[model samples]
Target: MSTTTSNHIGRKISRIRELRGMKQETLAEAMGISQQSISQIEQSETVEDEKLEKVAEALGVTKEGIKNFSEEAVFNIIGNTVTNNDNAAFFNNYPTFNPLEKLMEAVEENKKLYERLLKAEQEKNTYLEKLLSK
Candidate 1:
């Protein structure tokens, strides 16, 4: 493989990792490697295929997907879809749900449920004490 292609692949890996909100230390922990090793991998122009496969798995992307990744292409696609307001095309092309947002919403709803349950328990305890005193 050309040096340029290898360099691009390494850079792509780094970019995708950052976009996924992953720190080098976090990725290292996930892959059972050292943070320095993760840093070195990010800086490398070429990685062995086995190592590359492990990195891709840690980052939650396919090996081929990482090899072919392009930030500019992603931005262009998003720009076109958002600026054009062609909702149908955009929906058909990419996933609409944000997993993080959904998780946060679920957590908030659970918090509310917990609070209600606590209030009911307190009221029940108070009623039981009144009955016992009588």
Candidate 2:
């Protein structure tokens, strides 16, 4: 829709392909397209819906998959090691949450539960010692 929004998606697509250790030519061949087309896509703000679909399918991702990515995700993953305040400026400008967020939330919840269990066990052990001394 907006120039910034399209650029965000383009960046995401490029980033994912790179993370997968795939070259533009590799992705292009898998999608039955030319390397120039892949290069244009990675550099362009927008691509056709049909081509987008093909790219996603070839990459084993979803159509909405490439479009809804965020740089914050990668940052959150690597402990916020490297960040750009502007990296995600155009992301929420076009809002969408990928599954990774949900997975992270679940992991946090599990950690909390584990912590509570440990604390409860310590309390129980203290109570038992006090009772035995009585």
Query: Candidate 1 residues 1-134, lDDT tens each?
Result: 32334446677788889989999999999999999998888887777899999999999999988888777767777787675565565556655899899999999999999999999999999999999999
**Best candidate according to lDDT:** 1
**Per-residue lDDT of 1-134 in model 2, one digit per residue for the tens?**
32334455566778889877999989999988899988888887777898889888877889787887665666567656536555663344643776788899999999999999999999999999999999
Q: How many clashing pairs does model 2 include?
A: 0
Candidate 2: residue pairs that collide: none
Runs in model 2 deviating more than 4 A are 1-7, 78-134
- lDDT (CA) per prediction: 0.84, 0.79
TM-score of each: 0.56, 0.51
User: Per-prediction RMSD in angstroms?
Assistant: 9.5, 14.7
lDDT of 2 at 58: 79
Lowest summed-lDDT stretch of 10 residues in model 2?
1-10
User: Candidate 1 — worst ten consecutive residues by lDDT sum?
Assistant: 1-10
